[model samples]
Target: MSLAVTFAAIPYRRTGVVEMSDVGQVILCTLLLLAIAVAALVVLKRKGWLARWLGGSAILDQAPAIKRIAQTRLSRSTVVHLIEVTGRRMVVVESKSHIRMLPQDDMESHDPNL
Candidate 1:
């Protein structure tokens, strides 16, 4: 048995620096990938796959518990919504600090224009 060991040093040369076009290309590629990922995620979420992954109990056989009928912004931090649950329609006032039910007749029959 014979073993031969040989080593040769390779020469190195530096190239030109990265151009603005290169940076723009990288940024555009990154944004395109991100947009694709976001679109895919939206599709998955709408189809309830993401909900199943998150253990949200949303299944094909069952319908959603609450349905939003209408919504109005009361202020910057407050909102009023009309929602349907089971078979009842109700108005709900929601703020950052509290959530409470409102009278539908009072909200609808009482007009601010008067």
Candidate 2:
């Protein structure tokens, strides 16, 4: 009787190097940094420092250019808005399809109460 020997090939796998808790810690740290960055931006924007740093106008500090004095809805799809900008008052007509500013002289002739 002859005895035969055979060797089986096995693949090596890496294990135990990284734990689940370590992965969880990394994710938590990333989320925390993101949240902190967002909070800082909110604080800067609310205090108007962000705009100044970016060399843009501080919208919160400036007076509004257009002010709505009055508005009247003529119909379901049409409305008239009396607006003022830089001391000049004008009537704006808005419909479903278009918006237009009425001429200054025409508005006086059309509406005596204006």
Q: Against the true structure, what is each candidate's TM-score?
A: 0.40, 0.66
- Tens-digit lDDT track for model 1 on 6-77? 779786766547776798898999999999999999999999888888887556558877899999998999
Off by over 4 Å in 2: 1-21, 58-60, 109-114
CA lDDT of 100 in candidate 1?
Answer: 92
* C-alpha-based local distance difference test score of model 2: 0.88
Candidate 1 lDDT score relative to the true structure: 0.85
TM-score of candidate 1 relative to the true fold: 0.40
Error of 2 at 26 (Å): 1.9
Provide the overall lDDT of each model, using Cα atoms, as 2-decimal numbers. 0.85, 0.88
